[model samples]
Target: MNCPKCKSVQIIKYGHTHYGKPRFRCQDCGRQFVLNATRQPIDEPTRQLIDKLLLERLALAAIARVTGVSERWLQMYVFQKFYQTPKAIDVTPKKQVG
Candidate 1:
């Protein structure tokens, strides 16, 4: 397939996303783009589901199991707006909680 950046057909498969979508790199412009560029972004249904889980008393692993989203992903997307960066809290560690 041609690259979106350079419109060149010299693109090659670069990598795969965790979601299993193939990533491609443009040889001409050295730009990377997902092969399914036209695919729509994640929908609000998933976001709302995550928000509900965040409000409940469920743990990350418990939420992840029911929602089919990774524990790390659920935490970031749910708490993203509250924190400047998702790394502000470590999901796993021996640190004491304030």
Candidate 2:
């Protein structure tokens, strides 16, 4: 098979990945990769559930265990949300009653 990066036919069997997939190294570019690797994306309903859990102030690891998502991904998601939120807010306080 040709190398994905340099499109060169010169490649060698490097080793098996942690997932037991055969990985190849391109001789031209020295890039190693596995073919046909796939990642399943989390669904929208699960995301909504995660949002609700976040509102409840649940622990991140607990959320990851309950939601079947990786803690790293959840942390990145939270970081992205934090940056997307508005910086300023308007608040009005009531005067003290007699």
Candidate 3:
């Protein structure tokens, strides 16, 4: 089979991936990849839903339960999308006024 990255016919068997999928290395680009990459990316709709839930002030654990996504993944996704970490403001009580 040809290399998917460079479309080169000069491909060599680069052993198997962690899940035992056949991996190939392209001679042209020196890139190694599996035939069927088993990465399941979160879809746009799910991303939007996550953003909505976040805006609604939902707890991370609650959002994870509702969206079926891990809290760590949600945290990383939010950081990547907004280029910043979400933090809550700290409010302190003051003395009562006369």
Best by lDDT: 2
Worst 10 residues of 2 by lDDT: 89-98
- Using all chains and alpha carbons, the TM-scores for the candidates as numbered come to 0.41, 0.46, 0.44
Question: Which residue ranges in model 1 land beyond 4 Å of their true spot?
Answer: 1-42, 85-98
Ranking by TM-score: 2, 3, 1
Residue-level lDDT of model 1, residues 3-23, one tens digit each, is 766689999889888779988
**At residue 83, what lDDT does model 2 achieve?**
54
**Clashing pairs counted in every model:** 0, 0, 0
Error of 3 at 56 (Å): 0.1
Question: What are the RMSD figures for all models against the true structure?
Answer: 8.8, 13.6, 11.1
Positional deviation of residue 6's Cα in model 2 after best superposition, in angstroms = 32
**For residues 13-44, what per-residue lDDT tens digits would candidate 3 score against the true structure?**
99998788888899999989777532445667
Error at 46, model 3, angstroms: 0.7
